[model samples]
Target: MRVTRPMLAVAGAAVAAAALAGCGSGGDAAAKVPPTATGSLESLAAEVKCKPNIQTDADTIRQAICTSSAGKFVLATFSTDRGQREWINEAKDYGGFYLVGRKWVAVGDDGVVTALRGTLGGDVEIGTDHHAHTGHTG
Candidate 1:
């Protein structure tokens, strides 16, 4: 069977078109935890202090900071006015943070939160937007 140059070109174009179509339709398909699956406010408070970032702090302080003036953090599904859906951490006491995919953010008493953002890559690795180090304690 002999394939002509024109036939090969047409085949290549079709393959390209199919690839583009797949790319265009590709949206984040990961199953997000529903907002309604949240447990008790106290349980959510306990979970927050256990997180790596705030774990080192005293449990009392953690609870105060997380549940007191801060508020209870609940896992909930959220949608913007524009209808973009996201899994968010809705802080009931003090404002909390959210994890949209792997990105994380923390809200403080001032109601301002800092997000640790990253760039999505074809590889499974993510590059953080910032870095931090702790000073040695003598």
Candidate 2:
């Protein structure tokens, strides 16, 4: 039996759709929980009275916030501490900033507020203060 190109494309699309449906159904029931509402990073920084100095290696922080019983709803992750700090400093320079649950949050950069994943829980207040000196300034 020979399959035409169109037939193969249709079959592939059908399989992809089925796989996506299965995966969606397999999601955890707990994932439905809404993220926490930690105030903006800017507010946290102002409370501390220091510009954030975030680190470049902040995976530990992301895990802390992502798994916390109190703030697990946010689901943030930081590939690097430098990335996290860059967001904070950008927020300070701009304005609009808000925390999503505990893990990930958003801050204004350039002309838009962007969400960043894998953030440290404790560093939320300090923003990037702890990581600023570790040479992660990008």
Model-by-model lDDT, in order? 0.31, 0.40
As a TM-score, model 1 comes out at: 0.20
Model 1 misplacement above 4 A: 1-3, 27-138
Q: Which numbered prediction scores highest in TM-score against the true structure?
A: 2
Q: Write the per-residue lDDT of candidate 1 for residues 1-138, one digit (tens) a residue.
A: 256888999999999998787667543322222232123323443334423223323311222233333333222222232221221222322223343322222233222121121111111211232224336454
Give lDDT: candidate 1, residue 116: 20
- Model 2 has an lDDT value of 0.40
Model 2 lDDT per residue over 31-131, tens place: 43333335444443333233444433354343222212222222234444566555556654433344433434533231121222222223223233344
lDDT agreement of model 1 with the native = 0.31
Off by over 4 Å in 2: 1-25, 28-31, 40-138
Clashing residue pairs in candidate 1 are 35-76, 35-77, 70-93, 70-94, 71-93, 71-94, 72-93
